[model samples]
Structures are given as structure tokens and as C-alpha cells.
Target: MRSPRRQPVAGAATRTGPPVPPAWMRWLPVCYVAVVLILEPLTPVDWPVSFLLVALPLVTAFAHGPLVVAGATALAVVLEGVLAGTPCCAGRSVGYLWDRHYVADYVCTVLVGGLGTILAAHRIHRERTLADVRFVADIAQRVLLRPLPRRIGNLRLESFYLSATAEARIGGDLYEAVPTAFGVRLLIGDVRGKGLLAVETAAAVLGAFREAAHEEPDLAALARRMEQSVSRRAAHIGGSETGERFVTAVFAEIPADGRVVRVVNCGHPPPLLVRPDEVRELDSGRSGPPLNLGMLLTEAHHIDSYPFRPGEQLLLYTDGVTETRDANGVFYPLARRLRSWGPLEPRTLLDRLHHDLLDYSGDRLQDDTAALAACLLDGGPRSVDDSSEP
Candidate 1:
């Protein structure tokens, strides 16, 4: 459902690791200076105390601009000069001015500090460029996975999409919910492959489903339309490799006036029906093959009908969820997990599943995941608040 504008939380779990050091770390150079002040007086000046002076400016360069680094370098130079003239060693300002070792240490600090400042400037520029590119990619992803309204007719809806790759914003998984004359139609599917090829196929399927969901009254017919669309896309892609371009999908029809839910399964995982009393899988007696394989099948696709009582919720997801493996290589038990939740509201149901899936997989999904939860509201289809609970 459409939440307020914000950064996407999906796939964020994968970024979990060491926390970034705090921004206040920029003051570390000052702390280093204080430590040097205490240590230089205690230790003999002949212990090469001036060597420690280079560290303050270099550390400052990591978290600050060149100006700050320059200031730190100047401070280090002053402190070195002062330390060289201390009673611990020479005990005369002329000792630092004429001593070759003292002069050499000061020269090294200035050269290294200047180099660190230049490197820091370059790093900041590169980071800004990378951020701009990533921002554009994120926008493209949001456009691809447009936010679904929380309410469509009397149906409460919530949806999430997670791309498997860390560098990607969108992938092969796809889901769409459309309100039509027949009812609220839903489609959640996974393309056979990843990257641009899969995304192209997903786009074609969604375009076909949107157009046919309103025109085709029968759920099977709508699926056939999607099959044709995928076939055409495969033909256009035109390679021996494109022959493997089929999509596993579950197409659903929730009639506005009926207590029945009709589904057409195309080699996809069965959806979970979460009722107050029990959670059941809406299995087709014998499912048809995935989209783009109608020509290979001897039998026609069949639509399966099941009761969808009011206050009940239906959960549909791509194989990524069920097939997600833990570090120990155990598949996530989606049906069993749903049974534990009883009858949760749409948004909360998806949130729990999203978090649970990431936790189970150690936040590393091997395939793209997409999930949608729809609750059949009483009093037929009508718009409601963004989070209309069941």
C-alpha cells in the first residue's frame, strides 16, 4: 500500500554489519593532540616524538576538508617545534632550527599532510558522484514498483518487493493489483532469470495483465493473455537462451459480491489463506505450467475456486520467500509461519513476513522476492484509509 514518501526499507537488512563510526569522530585529531601533549613531556625528546606529529593531520583529512587538515598540520608543526626545544632534550629554540633531524621530521609532516588533504578532496568528489547515480537508480526502481493503494474497493492491501542483488533496486520479481469489473484482480510472479532480461519480461506481463484483467472476465483467459505476452517477448528477445524465459505466476480474482476467491496457478507456489481459525494453501488441483509454455502443454489451464470469507486474508509471494534458505540450508516454512500468525491485518502481516524472511536468510536473499497481502473487507469494495485493518 502507498505509505508516505520515504527511503525503501526492503533489502535494508542485507546492509547490516559493523555500524559506521560516528561523525563526531572528526574531532579525533584534537584528542590525538591532547595525548601527544601528555606523552611528549613524559617521554625523552630523543625518542623521535616529532614522528607522532604527522598522525594528527592525516587523521583529520579522513573526516574533514583540506582547510581543517591544513590547520591541523600547522598545529602539529608548532607542537613539534615546541617539543624539540623542551628541557627533555635540547632545551633551546635554536636546537630545533639547526638540528637536521628536527628539520627533516617537520618537512615530512608538511609533505604528507598536504598529500592527505588532496586525497581526501578527491574521495569526497567521487562519493558525491556515486550518490547522485544511486539516487537516480532508486527513482527508477520506485517507478517500476509503483506503490499500491492500501485500499482498493473493500479490499485492504499491502505489498513489498526486495531485489536480490545489493547493487540493484529492482529485479525479476513482479506483483500488481488492479480493480476491474469482475473484482480486485491480483498477479504476483517471478521471471525465469535476473537482470534486464527478466525485468523486460515482467514489464510485458504486467502490461498484458492490466489490459486483460478488465476485458477478460475469466481468470484463465486473463492468464492466457499473459502467456501470449510473454511468448511474444521471448520471440523478440530471440536467442536459444530465450527459450527458458517462462514466468511462474499466481493470478487471483476476488469478486466484490461473492465469498469465493478464484485463482489460476501457473507453476507458482500456492497462496496462503489466513483465516481466524486456520491458515490454508489455495492449491489448484493440477496447475498449468508457467507462462510462455502454453504451446508445450497438452491440457488447458483451469481456474481453482475456494471460499474467501470476510475478515480473512490472502498472502501471495514469489518463490524467493518459500525457497529462502537459512545458513544451515533449510527452506523457509511459509505455510507453517502463516499458521502461527492467525489472522493479522494486511500491513502487519507483510511486515512480519518481510522481517522474518530476512532474519532467516541471514539477510542474503539469493533471488528476488515480492509479496502482497489482501484482506476481503465486509460491505463490498470501497476505498478506505491507507491502513484499513481487517
Candidate 2:
């Protein structure tokens, strides 16, 4: 049921920087100068079209740096002097160059140009600071929520994560998949809150899952380990929010044969299982408490198994996906959308979902969003040995 890994398409949601400005924006100041030059000759002498050149430095500052703006300022001053000294339209004389009004105009242009230069410098500083912040955030994302492999053993995987904050690359959402001797174990969860504290809690849960997924043999034991890890982490981060801090998670296991998938739902949204005929939510019959709250409950965590045959896809997501609201406050119809679409590759399916979600929410998500898609391909080892490596 497992298949070999395939190469992913290029330019697949890998951007982690600020958007680039349009090429045309850089020429705006030059175009303005050209227009001013052309109108100067056609207008009457009293019109003084060269006065418009005072705005040149401000226009350049919109896209250029301080150095370029300074150059633009100098250019505007020189052009103004040239227009004043030249005898162009009727009733205009060269004496206009030394006119008191022209003298005042020169001082005004220089003052505005200085302001533009300062503006450009400040803009550049802010941009560099933003770039540095994004770089640090990207590194944190790699360490916390690393990108998932395109293919792992028999499972073809694709993942998507979107932080509600434009400058942040990661947030409270976290996920990881490890192919161990037991099978391909998957973990996806969301911390209770936002900010640095939430990020620290997410890191603790992911660190525990990465380690426990390899060592633990039983799926229930893995869940227990995660719960203990979160509890310990909460203790270490003791504060008023310690009791409020928790994580909703789903742990999944797909064997080498890929015939069935076992899942443990811990106060998280149920994953969707998409088949050629229909789509359904893989809801566990009994729900378990979220991580860090196991001590309060005596009931044991339950593992539910579902038929995960080849050609079927499994989608795990956070509440942000289902809870996204449109202009009318209508929630995104995730299940309905999946049912309407035809059979699609795992990557394509997620790509479509990402765009649809953004469109539904008008590109304004209220919380962090994360999704992981796995497709069981046909043709692989039916039974993997206990010592087998993925």
C-alpha cells in the first residue's frame, strides 16, 4: 500500500520574507520629472510648472532609499534654477532667476527635500528591522514546526501552516511525523493561547512527541507520555496561566501495510477521511481530555482504528480551519468543499484548501491555521517486521 517518494513541484509555499515592491514603482519619480519638463514649456510663464518639481523627492522616497532621494532632491533644485534662468514662454525674462519669490521657492524645495530624505532613511531602517525579525522567526519555525517530507515510507504527505500575524512564521500550532519501527506516527496539536508563552508550550509538546514517537510501542502510551511532558512543562512555566494552558492534539499511526490507521483524539477537531466515493470525519467513539489534564480524569485514553486503504487521503487540521468566518460570519464549509472536489493529489488538495480558506476569510484569519494531508498509495509491503525501518 506504500509508495516511493515523488519530487515536489517547485515554488510551493516557501516564501518567508516581505513582499517585493513592483518594478514600476521605482520609476515613478523619473516619470514625474519627465512630465514636469514637458509641461513647463507648454504652460504660461505665470503658471511656473517647475514649482511641481518640489514634490519630486517625496515621490522618490516612496520606493527609493535615502541616497537616491538625496540625488533626486539635488536634481529638483538644479532643474528649478534652470527653468527660472531660461527665457521660455511669453512675458518671461531671465531676471526670474533672482526674483525674491523664486528665492523663497528654492528654500521651500530644499526643506521638503530634507524631510523626504529623513523619511527615506527611517523607512529603510524599519525595513531592515522587519527583515531581521522575519529571519529570526524563520529559524524558530524550522526548529519548532519543521517542514514535513513530501513522502515518508508509504505515506505521501503535504503540510500547511499560516500564522495569523503577518510578521510571524510560526505560532501555537505544531505538528510532526516520524517513521519508526512501529509505523509512521503523526502528531498535530494547538496550544491554548498565543504569544511567547504559547510558543514555548508548543515547543515542549513537539519535543516530547518527537522523542516518544520513536521509543513508545503502544499508541496509548505515546499519548500518556505527551500528557506527562505537557504537565511537566506547565509546572516549569508556573504562573497564573498554568492551569489555563493546555493543548488539543491528535496522534495517528499508519502501519507499513497501510491498511488501517489508528488515531487518538484528545480534545481536538476530528480529522477528515476522503475517499473516492465520499468524505467522512474520523471521530473517535470516546473522547479524551486535552494534554496536561489527564490527572483530573480517570478514564484511559482510547485508540480508534479506521480502514485506511490505498488511494484514500487523511486530512488533519486545527480549529482555525473550520472556524474561519466570512463577511457574513458564516463558517467555512470544509466537509462540503472536500466532497465537491474530485480525486486530487495530496499537495493539490491542500493547495486548493489553503486558497479557498483565505478567500472565505478575506485573507484575515483570526487565529493560527495548520493542516497535514496524507495519502495512502497503492503497492508496498503488506506486513512490516517489528525491526523494519521506514
Candidate 3:
């Protein structure tokens, strides 16, 4: 029979608590079961004293629902108390060790050890369910954060991502792409911090962009919507200044049939212009601050337009990319390094850059790194109006 899926424990997680486990953390349960079996022989005393295996089932029990926990607890009770031999009761005569009370021992085991196991396993089951929910959240993000296309404008996109943490979860760093009336609008931004709060902000920004791209004809309006979304979120949190959350971002909209692109630099790193033969930063031509910083700095975001020629691609990213430190503690120079590697497809570029970035950091990051590359297609060749031709 199929094992019923478990559910997360309600009313357990506080806004501040232990971080959830990653999706790849399945082996932890198997490890838990193994530990239980190893120490089940002397539970509550030797088991708890030796290895705290009792806590394992308790935590596990908390994770699964009542039915599942009941099954596991019953099985463990039978195995440990009945089959494995319970301790002799009350020094009842040396001969009584294997006496007729065996049936009573079985019942006692079911009543006592079963209850204990049920409690422990329930906790564990709750934890596992919570972890599973968080994993699904991370996976669902990939849908809105689609992989960048192979080509844009005339440039070949090559991008890479590496989180500073061991668990490969996306947080703080964010990116997006959507077709608009003008052309394709893209964004790459970073929340002020890491973990769930940052992920939530990232989600809000992308969700707004996905809807705004199709509705807003002007890039300026699109930027405003995103800015409002962040502000609204901060307000919803209803915390003091120290409790406030914010993000820095860069928004860009490329024209369908031209070299002109509009960008709003909301306190983010400037994008780099990379070509087969040249590399330079796209002077954002603004003094505007980041999105959430607007409330603090009191500056209106300015829309800056720049030239995006064919054969040249723009690279946008979170600070994690350029700020990565080496053994000597020197930061990575993405502009110089990216130009050194010849043009590659979006996937290849992301993979290559991700690999090289990890190599620089020994495949581990202390923060999340997000990079996006958008290249203009057709270079300088006369391009047909493919939008309407089809």
C-alpha cells in the first residue's frame, strides 16, 4: 500500500525559528530511522543517555500526521519492547524473566513505548513536512525565474549563479524576463538580506514584473509598479525601522527593432557591456538610489536610456557575483573575467560562469550569486520585422 503523504504541523513556526531543510536533505530521515533502530534496544534511559535517539522519533512524529505516526510508533514498540525483550519487571524472580507476563509485556510496550515513539515521531514528521513545503517553494520559483534565452539583441547570453551557502537555494538575488510591446523587458535585483524574507521580496518583485510587462506600455510605468510593490510589502510587514526590509534593483526594457534601451538603476550594480573585442560598463547616467533606499535617501528614481548595439551583450547581476572573495580575500572582477571568455549561449554562459565563479570560491559561496546576460541578436545585419512576419 502507498504510504500516505505527511502534512506540515500548523502553528509551529514562528517568524523567527530554525531554518527549513533543503530539498536534497532527504537522507536525514533515513539517518533518523537508522539511529532509532541502533538505540531502540535501551530507549528512555540508555537510548536517550547514549545518543538521544528518543528525540529523533519525537521530532519525526511531530512531522507526520497522527495516522502515520501511530503506525511507526506501533511498529517500533513491537520491535523494541516485545521482540527485542523488555527489562524484567520489579525483580519478580530470576525465573520470571521469561514468564507468562510476556503478553502483559507486549501490551505494556504498546501502551508506553508506543506513546513515546508516537510523540517523538510526530515532531520529526512535522519538521520534515515543513522542510518539504519550503523545498516546493524553491522549486516553484524556477517557473517565474525562467532560464534566460540563448540569444537577445545581437549578443549571446552567458550567465551563471552560485549561492554563498552550501544549500543551493535562491534568495535575495532575483532576475526576470518578459516580452513587451517595445521589446523584451528584463530585470536583475537583490534584496538587502538573505533567507526567507529575501526570497519573499524577490517573489513580489518578479510577480509584479510578469504582470506589468504585458500591461504597461512604458518602461517608466513598469518601474513605478515594481517600486510600489516593494514599498507596499514593507508597509505590510509593519515593523519598526530596524524591522524594515528593502531591496536594490536594476530594471531595463529593450526596444524591439532598435539599439536603444531604457534602464532604471534602483541602487544596483551597473551592467557591463561585453563584446568579442571590448568590455565596458553601461554608464547608468543617474544619481538615483535603490528601490527601498528611496524612502531613506529621499531621491526619485530616474529612468536612464542607453545604447545596446548588436554583437554586444549586457551582464546584470547581484553583488554576490562581483563581491565573491578569493583565498587572499580579493574580490572577483566580473567585467574583466567575463570579457576574457569568448561569447557563449545563455545556458553555456551561465554554466561556464557558474563553474568559474565556484572555482574562484572553491564551489562555495557565503552569499547568493545571480548573473544574467542578454545579447542583441542579428548584430549589424539588416533584420526583418520578425514580430509581424510570422
Highest lDDT: give the candidate number. 2
Displacement of residue 370 (Cα, Å) in model 2 is 0.7
Winner by lDDT between candidate 3 and candidate 2:
2
Tens-place lDDT digits, model 2, residues 146-214 = 777777776788888876655567689988888888888988899998899899899889888989998
What lDDT tens digits, residue by residue, belong to model 1 across residues 1-390?
322222233322222222233567877887888887777656654575556987777888777777888888888888888777655453432455447887887898899888978976776776667667666666656556667777877788888886665556778888888888788899999899777887778878887887898899888889888888898889998988766889999999988778788999999999988899898888856888999888777877898899998899989999999999999999999989888877788888887887788778877778878899988887754532223322
Query: Weakest 10 consecutive residues, lDDT, candidate 1?
Result: 11-20
Candidate 2: count the clashes: 1
Give the higher-TM-score candidate: 1 or 2: 2
> Candidate 3 at residue 117, lDDT?
61
List clash counts for every candidate, in order. 4, 1, 37
Off by over 4 Å in 3: 1-138, 148-160, 242-244, 296-300, 379-390
Q: Candidate 1: give the clashing pairs.
A: 153-381, 153-382, 154-381, 154-382
Off by over 4 Å in 2: 1-20, 42-44, 382-390
The candidates, ranked best first by lDDT, are 2, 1, 3
- TM-score of each model, paired residue for residue: 0.86, 0.90, 0.61
The CA lDDT at 145 in model 2 is 78
